[model samples]
Target: MVDAKDLSLAPRLLPISLSVEAGQVVHLIGPNGSGKSTLLELLSGLEVPQSGSVWLQGQPVSGQTRYDLAQVRGYLMQQQRPAFVMVVFEYLNLVLDSVQLATGEIRDKAVADVVSRLAISDKLHRRIDSLSGGEWQRVRLAGVLLQVSKALNPHACLLLLDEPSTGLDVAQQAVIYQEITALAREQEIAIIMANHDLNRTLEHADTVVVLQQGRIVSLGPPKAVLTDRLLSDVFATPLEQVSTANGPVIMRASSS
Candidate 1:
């Protein structure tokens, strides 16, 4: 569980309290400068909150050591900036290996299943350098999923994702949503993902948190919290909410 109790950041995020249970995906969304990324970093143990607490499983999130935290949570940052030369399958093997010292027995089957689901089975033997940007993100997500799953112990596996769809195509984004859903149900992973695309998050997330000026302006389920009136007031624009067969999608006009 991710229990953030009245946590505050550098100069904002005042009186913020949130609870996310296992088998759930909570989407954090707001404007570019709203400090969504900062909140994610705090939750991921990369940054410490100035006050209050970020609790995981029953302990403070920031109190854990970096190495110990990595075992319990898998965080995918907004940028896929790492440079690596390993093949896709080999990279997947490396992730599984990091799960434990005695993981060779279950490694093969786990890698096969994750790759197959991400639609990267064919790209397995190919070096990651040869794959496209979207392909690499899928590979990254597969690695994250495997790591979080391995860390589970009769409880939820926490995952922190910061704008993970930055470089993904529409189809690839769809696959990621599916994987997130399945992981919550099958592996009981609790995800707190910061998303720049509010439309996508509103449609799929179990909970939505909005940050503004480093503060949480709103937090709730999608339909209940995201309103055209609220968006207009916060974004200083006449935002439109269009209802599609899938769900509501917000559209913003350009200033130019």
Candidate 2:
């Protein structure tokens, strides 16, 4: 569980409050410079809020508590560039090495599970620096997922992701979201992800938090919060909600 209460970061982030329960997938949606990244950083303990507080599993998050938080949380930032020319497997092994697992077999199984979920099994032997942008993104995501997997941290209950599907194609994006859903529903890891893709948020998110100029405008189930007027107002564009077999889809309103 994660709780951010009245969080503020000066001009960039305002008093934002949110709580994510175990097994829930919450999406943060807003335009650029809407403070999604700032909120995530505050919750991840990467940055301390000027006002208010963030709590993880009942412990307050601060610079001093970050080390303890890392034991139960995993954060995937917006950008990741491999500096070294290590193979994917080697890089993943390094990540696993940082955590205390019960056995080598457990580490191997964790790696296999995350790599398969992200569809990166084939890239295991490839150089991390040489992989395509999407491949590298998936590799980084796998590393983060492995950190929170039961094999690494059984107490891992929070996963924070900022624009996680950055370089992937549509299908790969779907795969990533599917894995996110599985982590929440199956592993009971509370997930808070900042994303630009609204439709995907509608499909996958149990709750959506809409931000504007550093403050929360709406926070609720996706369908209720992502109404036509709300989407148009938040995005500063004319939009419409259309019904489909899958669910309601938000789209640009027709001029005609």
Model 2, 173-208: lDDT tens digits are: 988998999899999999999999989988899999
- Against the true structure, what is every candidate's RMSD? 2.9, 1.3
Colliding pairs, model 2: none
The lDDT, on a scale of 0 to 1, for candidate 2 is: 0.88
Best by lDDT: 2
Quote model 2's TM-score: 0.96
Every model's TM-score: 0.88, 0.96
Q: Please, what are the lDDT tens digits per residue for candidate 1 over residues 46-93? A: 887888788898888776787678777888887563576888877876
